[model samples]
Target: MSDRQRSDTVHYDGPAGGWGSLRGITRIFGKEWNSPAVLETLARQNKPGGFMCTSCAWTKPANHNPLEFCENGAKATLWELTTRRCTPEFFGKHTVTEMLDWTDYDLEQQGRLTHPLRYDHATDRYVPCSWDEAFAAIGRELKALHPDEAVFYSSGRASLETAYLYALFARLYGTNNLPDSSNMCHETTSVALKKVIGAPVGTCVFDDFSHCDAIFFFGQNTGSNSPRFLHPLQEAVKRGCKIVTFNPVREKGLIAMVNPQSPTEMLTGQETQISCAYLQVKPGGDIAALMGLCKHVLEKDDEAKLEDRSVLDRTFIAEHTTGFAAFEQKVRDTSWDEIEQNSGLTRRALKDAGQVYVEAERTIGIYGMGLTQQVHGFENVAMFVNLLLMKGNIGREGTGISPVRGHSNVQGQRTVGIAEKPELVPLDKLAQMYGFEPPRNKGLNTVDACEGILAGKVKAFIGLGGNFVRAIPEKEAMEEAWRRMRLTVQIATKLNRSHLINGEVAYLLPCLGRSEEDLQASGPQTVTMEDSLSCVHGSIGKRSPASEHLLSELAIVAGMAKATLPPNPNVTWDEWVGDYGKVRDRIEETYPDQFAQFNERMFTPGGFYRGNSARDRVWKTESGKAEFTAPKHLSATGFADAPGRYRLITLRSNDQFNTTVYGYSDRLRGIEGTRNVLLINPDEIKRMGLESGQMVGLETDAEDGRTRRIYGLAVTPFDLPDGAVAGYYPELNVLVPLSHHDVQSKTPASKAVPVRILV
Candidate 1:
């Protein structure tokens, strides 16, 4: 190898074997499971047997074998079920000021919080408070603020029961400030799908993988982000299905995958080839590529006299869809030059991809953050749906649009009514079911909530589960907003930067994690989760609580609600808090057809699959059909269009999930021990007159003159596309301006940032 190669390469010195290998051996010998607590939780995940997987929103069969967990899943599990503890005594020794100096990993590594802590600004320390005191203080602060002056935030990890009750409490209190993790992740998908197909969820299920003849994956890294998907990707390939990948970076999962479960492949070091074709598009070029594909499909179908072919579902389109002619004309009018320039791909490549879809009997398009974190994210998703509609892919066995959701129960939370604005049916039903007038006003979303806090319009912030302050873009602004709040309540399992932000009366209330048992008045309680595939499953905790005082999220939310809400004769909050089954009963009452047998279905393996419009080729659009939405214009922003600037894409390492770091180890990329580095193309490094391992600064092009910079970042050149660079998220989140967000989804365009590399 050349000296340049040696300098650019990352070295791993932690332990032999990649994260997967170490985890496997550890699971056998009981080496602390060597996985995240979330992974361990997933191992026990089933319809009613164990806790819900606190990782991704993807669902699986409840009858899967014992070792169904993936590497990152294990990391999530271990991180949650660690032996470390942050007790009241521990807090007494270290003030909030002192803890603020600690890194994010160090704060969380201190382990599960054993008690509720209130930040005492006078002493600059977080002191332990009894549950009664914590609830009372929260109630006092919340009740004092106008309903619209408070924001209720929910993380995807929150269960259906807690989310339902949270929505109830927020409405009863007359506030719609329901900012959640969903607003930050897949809101674009929701907006786009709803506009085009009248549904926000994916149309396909996990079983669809078996029936798919071809899978077109765009802007998603299945191996690292959604590890559970690797099995399906491998299976589809083995079944002779064509897998086409479109991404800026070539992910290992998209190339060749080695199933840890397969004996032959594991022993021989052989890997399964996943993608038949790989298209490397520029960041934020998804819409252009998709349009190009649509154009190809239209042209090919017309020439072959297949315009009204069986694959097109002409009947469904004529009966249910609107805006077809206009959209088709728009597609026809689009110039190939414009497509190539905007998508950064030649027409031949676009035609090749479209041909794969045209010839296939069933095709599935799976996308992730890559498509949703762009300026026109919602439009990109709409284009995907439009492509599916053109081919009659929706409401089918193996063909549909599948958006890989982040966070375990995010979709589930949305299903159970964790929304800023409740739909008309659910809102009216909830009001009737609870015998109270629920607020009909739309609530604040994630971005709106942050803006509210910054403006001091929101005085209290209640987060069910998540590090809201750190996860958001413009960290400094978010933290400052959090500090200005009159009260902040975090119902969490572990310590996070959010808690350390320290509101005027901040309370970090320890909650039972997914792995911890929830023994309520009736018996052991299990929470339900709705996966990305629209499968609802039960989750019961197995391990003991980190502390006896640690309450389940449902109980905490109930307690706070009881203390804050006005007296009501309609529903019994205490009864539901005492037993989670009652919460399910209420859920069934609110959404009768959806959760009719909520409790009984828990016993059924894999629970039940929710209603899917795609399976029946039923487009739920306003016209009762899937509509093709054409791009109004073609424009490319971000670093891709910024001449002499590198488009910096923020990614999560294999060892990390979201903002939680599990040690700086990226096995596939050979990165270890640190996240403060940049992955650049080697040729770009030479052209820039820079050497490997040399620290550099990344400056964003902004009019405000506020430069976002990171120091000591080693430039590790790799196989990145020209003028493109990659780095870990959250660490690089600061580089993403709050204004640089998808206009429709309000999701920060973290995947595409314009930055200039400087020595």
Candidate 2:
């Protein structure tokens, strides 16, 4: 039996990130971090010479506390810098067949990969292979096929340097089949914001939190996902700023926050309340809730006119916006009954929430995956922008859209260069600079890549970083397609489940972690990363390599470029590999307007913000002015109201970050020892004659007429909306069909999956 089996249940009645966090950190990284070398590297984290924490993308403050790290940051850092080694000897001892039995957490915890590895069919194991041989083999396969047959995938953890090189390599090789992690998380934010505001990124910075009048958190749990982000919220509360939240569950983080770093608070077991008002809406109802607020605002504005009061920002709308009349008309025309039914909130409750908004001069709207992982993801984002436009909440301090991203540098990857579509910028400019005609054809995204692989249209898939297989939905379908690929390559640091689920030919190219030194011909180099607020800064690793065999992500990209395009003297792949400054120089040369003083400015403390024109009130769209959209997304709450049906909201636990499970328990939600449990409404459980902790199975209510079932899941009755049940993901990913996605942004509709539970 395993530790998970021994610990069937646990009760947690504690605040978020206090003593519980200290216990978690000590439990995970206490032993190995006592050493001198590891301690030195830990000291360098989030300081002047240190790299950014590999956890969340919450921007580092200009003047941060000496202990400037969170519990999850420590977990991520120590997990990467662990002394345990997964070498050829370890591979010889444990075959690929044996690895399939290990849990996802246990698989990654086995240790770091030390060298390049290739799967051997006869031995049923991965055998050590030389880097040269591995690169040569991949190059041969890539060169053998049409460029469209290859898919170059990326993860958010990759730095700007590696991402740029990967994009250049793919375009030179003649394909834009570059699917990245952004497609799954914040793509809708980008798409919707671009259509309305001419920039996909946010308009606010860290300082905005301090100056904002009121802050609204929609479908986001900040305390658990990004604990450090709570600092601003706590401070905002202290200064009398109202903080409001909307979500399906009453998340512990939003309810209260306790910083583990504070000794007095930790000793006294006290926590600070974060959200002044929390509205618990049903799953997939963000748009309806937003619309309800909008409807109330319009009604108040109409009444304000009769009372000779200023409710709307008439000057800003007249000068800076278009389509507001139509947008206002649509909101006014929407029925209160439909809004109430879809939002799971009374009209009175919505009016109360809208009163807070009406009273504030400036408000900031913040959201997470809960808003973007639905069928109306783009519409959800658009509605928030619409709400802001009505109040003139953007292009000013303490007011704008803030989508809290997951990875440390997810925003940077796209800003530098990583996308399936190649026409985001000028192709002629890129061709003139790089001396290559970039592919104008559209290529595979995350979903399309899986489809291409299933149909045997994709011959090779190379991941720069990330557990591509586990992060995506449609687990069974992806597993089959993943195995059918002629060649699959992963450039990663730790051993993920994606490595175990092998292709016909698979290779694991172990790379250095964020804290490890990257030495090239130009001496040690520092990689840059962009945070959620668009601040680009240098990340210089302060630790030695875990294994001497490790290669940097920059080196890996350069090696691939050299292998695929030989006799290409002008590209300078060999020279650039030795000194990464050359790569930055080229990046500056390519995107001169945005990154003019790239190398010089990054060395400065705290770096600089990559300025967004939208922040300066310059709209770069066709209209040359900010536009308001009447989005097509309405309430999806009716889909789950049918008999014997529930809407499954796929989420991550407090102990987990994305697909990387730190532990089997969620301390915030009172879960322990296993991921195979569901949180349902207690009232519904009684009505259905079902007892808590009983076994149940779920089948997706998909439109394709195919039943997708996941069985033997343990159920836990709790306080949830009537038709909603919550479950942790990658474990329950089978219920989310690949085809079920947002029509506008193509993001997976993980939060809107209508499922039937078998009692």
Candidate 3:
């Protein structure tokens, strides 16, 4: 690497979105688009009668805006619409072994895949093959394996239509091993919220921000993961909504932000102060922090009762909840010392935050992977629910739990039946509709599927979308075991590392991106996606596809199903492929309550919301009331005993989305030309006798009888709390043991991997 391109920090002290954001947008747009025609397509993003933004799951406004996309959203759009193509010739020139040494950014930069390619063992290269031939080979292998031995994985990028068909195809094949992107991220939210609030999805909509008195953010980075969310935060701040943030690092976006779309602010360089209070909590300390807050609320209620005043919503508690006594007792039994030690926050700080919660008439609690990707992630989510239940924050217009989901349709994928847990979906209804007995046995999640592969139990792997191998934990182990599978199929838009990590009979099926037009035999087809807010909307592409050979995700899945299964009278794969409305009609038949008038609602302006019952105080649980659960431990991560070890948080860069690295630099953090550097507290660096920019190594403290380490890492000084170090994800996923995950959710504890630095 050149000296100019070497890993180093360039200090940035400005707000997140402003002139800096404009420059980044221009750079990416110029590099990706060759003509101004692409702007028309870009303008339609997240707007009425257009495509959904393929970046984050942030919702679109009820009213229309000219340019609705943010910086990272534009990057994702342009990245998909790039003119560059990875053709058959390109694959012929490079063998899989040679490309293994390339960086992830370089691999994707090679551009979109244009043709169906199959791995040839003799040549050790991917050779172009006809779609029909590829599907036949996949069917043969899938037919050879036991139903439980095949893992059908889906990425979050797929539309609800595609996800529905994918799920149906898998179940018809006699298995329910439908692990998806949610398993690695927000599965904890779904599992915990369902057990407590009797609903798995967030209850807030865009309008909720306008009505909210305050918004409490826990471990969610609005700037990097979901930049478009800053607009609502900006508007909420302007309207006097108190925005309080609790995170390990003081992220720039949550502190203050300047809306780039506002002309007056953009020209005058005016910035809006976002957070009224910013609390720098320790990594994996959210559970303790929440407990402290609940304890403070209880104490405040006690004092209020003496004066005939009430801080707690006693009426709501009596009418709408259960287990309050048990939850309150658990909080009372906890001591301040334990809270402070585990949370790494003073009692006063927790009390102050609790006071804010106590005073606000309507408040929303928002969190991200930081809270969900922990060892006790279920407890972290449940504690947040308990805090909200104390104040009756749920089942209201502007007050609820909002787990800010990553990926555009991760929640939608789950809603459409892409789940490993059999009970989560309507198996009986599916069986009745499809004329086949659906699998009732529990299926394998992401971690379990990978374990199955390692144990030589799983024989085939198929992904509808996403770079599965690169995005999951225990990647190195998975890559080695992946080769042992009899079949592996990836339905993707671009070439990724997962394509190179091929099995013996692997096929890469190129599919249409969200922005590309899907011209079916019936006509131009519009697919639908459910946003983070549970609002279902239609996405119709205007731009032509990247290549003629590429097929729609719907077509690819339908073709695979047709080729794999015998001619069943119940399934009309050809008809569904010809007209997407047939697929929607079937979805409505399968999930009538959620998808009633699915086709008619597709035309509604800004789409429609699948109502959350918890918002209406309607509990779907067995007890017929919202319940609060107590945690046995205060710390979210089970690493309190491992003193002196740094809790490593695997985060995303501003220039990236999920696991896709767009560039070498993280402009938000002022880091240039590298993703391999570590961000640690300056005090922690000094205490360990390590200087800034020193090369070091990190080894896992998991002690799982296996060696997991990464070397040649540069240490950079950051302003995070002590005992917490941050690094880019996937790079550090190696140090996180596969078994180190929440037992309830099975989400890999990527946020709290206990590691020791080596000099």
Q: Quick one: best TM-score, which candidate?
A: 3
> Considering lDDT, where higher is better, how would the candidates rank from best to worst?
3, 2, 1
Pairs in steric clash, model 2: 521-578
Candidate 3 ranges with C-alpha deviation above 4 Å = 1-11
How far residue 661's Cα lies from its native spot in candidate 1, in Å, is 0.7
Give stretches of model 2 more than 4 Å off.
1-12, 31-34, 636-640
> How good is model 1 by TM-score?
0.94
CA shift of 284, model 3, Å = 0.8
TM-score of each: 0.94, 0.96, 0.98
TM-score between model 3 and native: 0.98
lDDT winner, 2 or 3: 3
Put the candidates in TM-score order, highest first: 3, 2, 1
Q: What is the C-alpha lDDT profile of model 1 across 526-594, one tens digit per residue?
A: 888888888888877878788888888988998899889878877688889778898899889888878
Give the Å error, residue 551, model 2: 0.7
In terms of lDDT, model 3 sits at 0.87
Writing each residue's lDDT as its tens digit, candidate 3 over 368-434 gives: 9889999999999999999998889997888889989889999998998999889988999887787
Model 3, C-alpha of 330: deviation from truth (Å) = 1.6
Pairs with backbone N, CA or C atoms under 3 Å apart (clashes), candidate 3: none
